[model samples]
Target: MRNPETILEVDDLRVYYATPQGDVKACDGVSFDLRSGEILGLVGESGSGKSTATGGVLRTIGSPGRIVSGTVTLDGEDILKYDDEKMRQTRWQKLSLIPQGAMNSLNPTMTISDQIADVIETHEGRQPADALRERIMTLFRRVGLPERIYSMYPHELSGGMKQRACIAMSIALDPLVIVADEATSALDVVVQRVVAQTMLKIKRELNVSFIMIGHDMGLMAQVVDRLAVMYSGQLLEIAAVRDMFARPAHPYSEILIESVPTLTERKPMKINEGITHDPRNPPSGCIFRLRCPHAMPVCSESRPDMVEVHPEQLVACHLWKKDENGSYVRQSV
Candidate 1:
């Protein structure tokens, strides 16, 4: 299939956190493209820079956290260069974020309509009460929230309903790209499924691209068109979701797949026993070398460049040898 138009591009993006000890490279040399209307999943263990990368996209890097380098292009414009005033305009209308713990993001005392109206009015200026209510009602229906709940307080709704409200606010201005930072993680299995379906519907109906940030590979596989695996603040692999499942080019990606419970097949998975990744002081060369079973001497000596192992699949590892054209070729089994 042909690739869709690129809506967002991240090049060598590096975000660091300042602490007493030293700078923690939360997102180091991360790069990827988010195509139009595509749901791209960023999956990794906790503290693997998944959240930080999403922050970089939204330009929401908080105190002590700095985006030291890299360019984040949104709709053909480098958002990193956008002034605060410009960024304020870009947010919600051009790019929006559905923060993690979305249920908690909603104000406790405010009515759902009031919260959503705040976003619309702040960006698009004050509209007639009738027009504003109509717009909010449209968003409510789009996200599957009942019309009656529009004036209800956040506490009046269930966890799932509150999350839907949050989603409604995120899409209040009809953004081109939505960064869902673990949007469905806090809900129960049934509720998670419902929210996922709602998100898919929005994508289909609105033709909006998404950056789905989560650690649940199985859940991500259900909705994401592509997946990017990150570890120790570095991208280990990126590929079509099906391709990553069939043949994970990076050892780290393969191990992650092995850890997933399969419905049809059951086999002993190779566990990386006692291996831990410390972001503050990662390994010498490849960040995953310490845990990788197939680590070679070169893996500890030099960092590996990202190379294409197959069409639309890229892996960064020393196990793969380079060809005459400097393309990555799999080693003999």
Candidate 2:
């Protein structure tokens, strides 16, 4: 069910990759909502399909990967049905990507001004060259970049500066939603903090919705309004950041939060043993059963549906039984 305030709705989204072995279900029946100006942080280990799920939103699934079935609606319009040309027009203007390696995404030969101007020309070509330059300069200032850096090549700027430029470019068209996939993973802690602040500033100023994909739980806690935990191509839990940190519902989510280092809590760290389940041949019942500490016989016998355990929080786990009112009650131990 789509929320009334949702700007982007992903319903039963399934993206698969066809390989010689079999079909790899990169995104299996993922459904979620990105409300207007909401910052939703998607967190999971590598290969958990966090990036693939967001990639589906932009229809950027490359060769061998295809969105098998889904409806990605933006503002009541299903973008999946749009033809190639129509979809091309939606990029940047409606949605944009702050790629994983922002620095590497820039063109080595082109100046920052030229690259940003090119995006403006492609999306809103009616503007004059001076107007485009002015817009670029405004974006540069918005992202905390100086006007002088406009003529500099990507390599000429530092890593953090390059990332800021990427941010400026992403918001150049005033996109409604920005999918920042690992935008701060490569930067130092100080630089990461700065970039994160930059993103928050942009969001507050532009009122742009963000779907940030990263492995940093602490960082996510600081910025995101909600957290979506994924495992083996499936959403395990979704809740407000405060609620999630206070009490995680899913077993996988609990472990993920416990794994992080905290200044207040000093305890012996336990390493995760098994690897993530293979997407091509996931476990029959619950894909996470093999690693879940609280896994019961029922967990291995049937998959659990996502149910509301508390207000504004949903989780998929057999430990909780759903009642008539659609609220989940924990089974007696």
Winner by TM-score: 2
Off by over 4 Å in 1: 1-4, 264-270, 273-275, 324-327
Residues 1-333 of candidate 1 have per-residue lDDT tens digits of 224599999999999999887899989999999899899999998888999988998899998999999999888899999999999999999999888997678888788999899999999888999999999999999999999997899888998988888888888898999999999999998999999999999999999999999989889889999999999789999999999988999988888888888788878766665338556777889988888878888889988998777888988988788789987788753
Global fold similarity of model 1 (TM-score): 0.95
Candidate models: Cα lDDT each: 0.89, 0.91
TM for every model, in the order presented, reads 0.95, 0.97
Provide C-alpha RMSD values for all models, in order. 2.0, 1.4
